[model samples]
Target: MSLSLEKILSEIEQLTPEEQLTVMGYLVELVKKHLTQAQPKHKWSDLKGMAPYPLLSEDAQEWVSRTRREADEHRERLLQGEE
Candidate 1:
């Protein structure tokens, strides 16, 4: 709609596939930079009590055990080349 955008689009259309991909990657990085600058940073204490349920020590232990078991199984499967 804007003249600048129209000009950019016309130029992009003329680029080779690889050049277009490079321009797209550059644009993605620019968008990520703008987004990070616009967002606010949070401290760990500020996120306290954010969970719906209270997290107890036992709950944490159980979670660690389950994750470890799953990871070990995954590694075993990978070593065996199992699909």
Candidate 2:
């Protein structure tokens, strides 16, 4: 373990049970937010030619359009009470 982590753990050990729980919850949320913000937000151009398969840009666009249309149709059917 790193020195910083060790010091934090030692300090946490001195806290009362309720305070410890609060600190633990805060740390959990902090770590979660940090990890979420660390994720890469790639643009379409960034991933343009990175697919393993031989898929063209037009092919990808078509797939997206078809998928969205299907989803919309499904949602409409559901909304109309037609499972």
Candidate 3:
């Protein structure tokens, strides 16, 4: 819903001390909601290789490849158990 400054001022004036606090809380929540909603959605795959600096060493790269291959083979073996 669209809000006008006059409407907001009138609403503020109508609020009790406790209600005013609630209104402030609600406004903060509203700002957070809108901000997060406006932001673009992303995925790990979408940002793959986008790092400003490389975070892996040559040994770490080798370990990652070996671990991934082992995990794939283990997954296949587990699937074979199901069959």
Candidate 4:
């Protein structure tokens, strides 16, 4: 069926608060599903060595490696605690 702004507004006005909320929630989910489906999927092979990374300074690289090591150590501690 054809939809117009006035008709849609009238229908919305006719519904109780709960029905209106339900309709809005369903509409939001429909929009999200459509958007996700519309996005193009990329294959790893399609990217040559994955996207190129910008040149990083030696200091930045060292900082990143240190931070990663610390994070891994912390994660291991957490897992040991959980056990």
| Runs of candidate 3 exceeding 4 Å displacement | 1-3, 47-83
Off by over 4 Å in 1: 44-83
- Residue-pair clashes per prediction, in order, are 0, 0, 0, 0
Candidate 1 lDDT tens digits, 1-83: 99999999999999999999999999999999999999989899998888755375357678899999999999999989965
Candidate 2 C-alpha lDDT tens digits along 1-83: 99999999999999999999999899999999999999978888897657755465457678899999999999999999954
Q: Number of the top candidate by TM-score? A: 1
**lDDT at residue 2 of model 3 (Cα atoms):** 52
Candidate 1 residue 12 C-alpha distance from true site, Å: 0.3
Question: What are the RMSDs of all candidates, in order?
Answer: 10.3, 8.6, 9.8, 9.5
Per-residue C-alpha lDDT of model 4 across residues 1-83, encoded as one tens digit per residue? 45797799899999999999999999999999999999989887887656445435356578889999999999999999999
What digit string (tens of lDDT, one per residue) describes model 3 on residues 13-82?
A: 9989999999899999999999999998988899876764445644667788999999999999999999
Question: Which of 2 and 3 is ahead in TM-score?
Answer: 2
TM-score for all models, in order of appearance: 0.50, 0.47, 0.42, 0.49
lDDT for residue 61 in candidate 2, whole number 0-100: 72
lDDT of 4 at 71: 100
